[model samples]
Target chain A: MTIKENIFENLRLELRRGCLTLAVLAQLRQEHYGYTLRKALAERGLEIDESTLYPLLRRLEAQGLLSSEWREEDKRNKRFYRLSGDGEGIFVQLLKEWRAINASIDNIL
Target chain B: MDLLDRYLQAVKKHLPWQRQDDIIAELKANLEAQLEDKEAALGHPLTAAEAEDWLKQLGHPIQVAARYQPQRSMIGPALFPFYLYVLKVAFLWATVIWTIVAVVQIAAQTPSELTVLAAVLRVPGMLMTTAAWVTLIFAIIEFVAARCPGKFPMLAPPAAHWTPGDLPPLGQQLSGGRKPRSFAHALTEVIFGFLFLVWWLLVPRHPYLLIGPGVLYWHASPFQLAPFSVLFYWWVVGVNVVQLAWRSADLIRGSWPRPRTAQTIVVSAIGLIPLGLLLSVPDHAYVLLRNPALDQARYSAALTSINLSIQWSAVILCAISVLELLWGIGRLSLDRYRKHAAAMR
Candidate 1:
């Protein structure tokens, strides 16, 4: 892409950044592994690549916003991630804030 | 194992050491799980194209990871104090180094015949050295500050902005203050005035020299010194008188106002005239072209004296510039503080 196009793309990406967390939380309502979460998000029209989704899950886990455990099935181990207690609280707060902001924007529009 | 591994490796390339292993493990687990889900959904083992397509949809690894962590601000809450501290240390170190190099260079050079070239060369070393020292000191402070974060509360997070309406009136701050003009202000003017007068008088005479042959000597022309010589002397007297007046005035008034900017500018201008003459006139050109009548030592001495005078003048100019710049900074800081205080009120 041209420099200007790249810059605009970056700005668009930044604007969409906040929604990514919501999308991650919404998809991980059930225990989902990193790859499964990415596919689910893509299917839901929030199309996150694996590279983006994996680290995010890790960070969310680190911040006590996600819980995860290694499970072995069919002789292969998979790390499954689910919402932590704190994650649930944060997700609810985020969802409320998002709704309020959306409504405010709707009013302004 | 193929394109997926390569893609994963490429993503890992961008991450720092501490998080790299964890990130890699997380990604591997996630990607493996994704591949399994895809296989289950399709009810068959996935083809390479299918896997590539899935990975492609995931976007670049770094971009994906970056979304999870917001970029740290360049002048962020965590780093600004450190940055300013580094800046100040660098400035201080640079100042010290420059002063040392300047003093040494001036001491070593052949003296008496003041040339513009000698003056110009002396400046950069002093400037660079001073800048380096200042930066070094600030950097050290910042380093210490990083360890003991609370020590510098003034430089902490949530940077404040100064606005015009927020400033306290300048007159109010200066009025009814007890301390007279600072010794620094008085000392600076006196020292500068003294140096200027001394350079002017001694430089022309080639004073403190072993008179030698093939040396060029310069005397200040009557026209250059005409009015200013008298005014320069009077200004020195005036500065002392003003210093005394301000001191006595402080006995009645609580505070004294800062030295007026106009006075500084005028004094600086007066100082520059001799400097301009020194630079514009080629004092040593004639020495190289014409043999002088004096003895070898006497002529060499004359040349040395002129060279030393020029070096000293250059140093003085540099010192003056530094002082003015510092004064400007002080003025700015005071203005900002007043504005901040007013805003709080």
Candidate 2:
């Protein structure tokens, strides 16, 4: 890649990094398995790679921000996820912070 | 289904053993789900090439598995800056000390080419040993820090006490006080300084390097450097040690900071002291013992010519040293004035 494109890719990744976490947390408010959650987000135009999404779900569950359980779905065992009580609280605060940032950026622009 | 199983098995290899089965099961479900969805859209089973293409888009299995593993570093980001700083300072000091020792050895006696080569070869081994020790120490620090975060004040973040006032002054940032030396300039100095050091060490064993074909004439005749000039040779080597060390440090640091620029003036001034002593050795005193191995008159004539050249060379060197000192002082003064002006602004 050209240097400019490489720089843009790096910056784009950085910009998306925090937002990706917020989006995942927001999406996990209702129960959804890994594959369905990814598909749900992709259908809404936020296309995350399966590799990135699966690991992130585990990390969030580990951090007590999300809860998970293995259940048979459509004749296959799939790990389902949803925001925990702590996750719900955190997600609400994060959504507030996100909206504040968006409003500030809009004002600045 | 076979291709999908192979991919999940490949990913399973790279995952942590405890989580391998659990992670692979989930991943397998996800991939099969994706394949099913793709088949549903096309209303047909995927061919082998179609399956391969889908797996390729997901990336290599190792890459896919790697994301599942926790990120690890020998020296994590928190301690990395200190680790690097320690290594640089340690290497710089080591290089400086080594150069000093090498100069002293050469001054004491001219070493053979093989001996010089052996000494040169030892340097890489010394640097590697130093690096290994430094890295091991930092790795231990990283281990400790990982287990007990904020235990070491050095590694702890200054979050609680930090304020806007801790920021650097606007003027200092804008002016960029004492700009770093260019890599090109430092590299050139290092290359030439190293070459000069090698040449200087070689000169004693092979006088021909200095005087060229004139060494043959001097050898055939009986004129050699006077006793004082012989001592002066060692003195010159000693003075050059300081220059070599300073330049080497500058090359390593990629900057001539205030202390180094000050050392430059001091070194140049010290250099002139020897040249003054050299000038005091009397004009005819540069060459001693004129034995007539060839033609007596011709040898004497050549001796007188060589002696005059030596005297003139000393004078020229003395002038150059003085100019170097003056230039250093001027540059230092200008740097200070610029800094002062920037601060005031």
Candidate 3:
């Protein structure tokens, strides 16, 4: 890629990075395993790569923002994740902040 | 399929070992789900090649594994610039000490103007050893920093403690207080070098310059400068010329040059020729006075003491010279290397 294109790609990734965490937490309010969650986000036009999604799940769980469990489904094991008590509170606050930012950006644009 | 297992195993290699199995299990379940979904869409089982292509979308093993790991760095980006700066500075000192060691060895063993090049030849080896050692040390620090984030606080920039108000005025630094040695230090070196060059060239004809304060007290009979061999004159001149050139360059460049590891090695080796010459001169060689103070016995004892003082003074000077040169090398190295390191950052 040209340098300008590379720079834009990097800047675009940085722009998306903070939003991805919020999107992941919002999706996990309803229970879903990794593949299903990725599909749900993709369906909403906000696809996250497996590499990014799985790690985000692990980090969120580690931080007590999400809870996860392993269980058998269709004779195969799946690890399902959903928002924890703390995650639910934080998600609500973050959602409010996100909307404020969106409104600010919309006004500026 | 074997391909699926292999991809998981590749990822497993990079995962934190304590939690590796759990992460692998979770990862395996996710990948299996992906494969199942793909198969359902195609209405068929995937071939090995298709399965491999499916795994490729996950990312490389290193990249995938790194996500699970904390952002691993030997030295984090914050400390890496500093760590590399320290190493580059260390390389300068290493090259310098090696240079001195080479010169001293040659001056002591061969004492010829010709052997200066041999001493010069040994500099790269010194720099290489130093560079290796400095790198190894930073690597160890990096290992510690990556494994335990809180340890090695020096690895962090001052921003950890800094308020925006702590910043200097607009004229102040982005990274403050890492500048080259002042022009005064270089100027002093140049002045001293010029003085010494004059002293060596003319101390033969005018003996008063040799006797610091006693010139008025003693009879003004001139003693010969015959004891100083011709090779000795050339060696001293060469040493002074180097100092003059180096200090002059520092003055001009406003810092030491990018360590031409090879050139620096040679220059440092040549430096020893003079230092060795100063040390090896016998205590009785500097008898700059011919006529005695009317008291012969007292005068002979006093002359002996004078020669002895010169020898002792030279010894002290040599020790001090070695230390100061090492320090000079350090400062010069730091100035040059910091610029280089900052550029990399």
Q: Which is the leading candidate under TM-score?
A: 2
Worst 10 residues of 1 chain B by lDDT: B217-226
All models: lDDT?
0.60, 0.81, 0.72
| lDDT preference between candidates 1 and 2, better one | 2
Q: What is the lDDT of residue B56 in candidate 3?
A: 87
What's model 2's lDDT at B180? 50
**Which portions of model 1 miss their true places by more than 4 Å?**
B2-25, B33-78, B81-108, B111-155, B158-345
Instruction: Estimate, for each residue in B77-154, the C-alpha lDDT of model 2 and write its tens digit.
Output: 866877888899888778778867876675566566876787789899989998999999889877887779767866
Per-residue C-alpha lDDT of model 1 across residues B134-236, encoded as one tens digit per residue = 5565455556656587877664443343467885665534422434466466545444543443343333345433233322432331112223334444444
Model 3 stretches astray by more than 4 angstroms:
A89-104, B111-118, B142-156, B161-226, B229-345
Residue B186's lDDT within candidate 3 is: 54
DockQ (0 to 1) for model 1? 0.58
Clashes of 2: 0
TM-score of chain A of each: 0.91, 0.97, 0.97
lDDT score for residue B11 of model 1: 75
Give the best candidate by DockQ. Answer: 2
lDDT of 3 at B112: 39
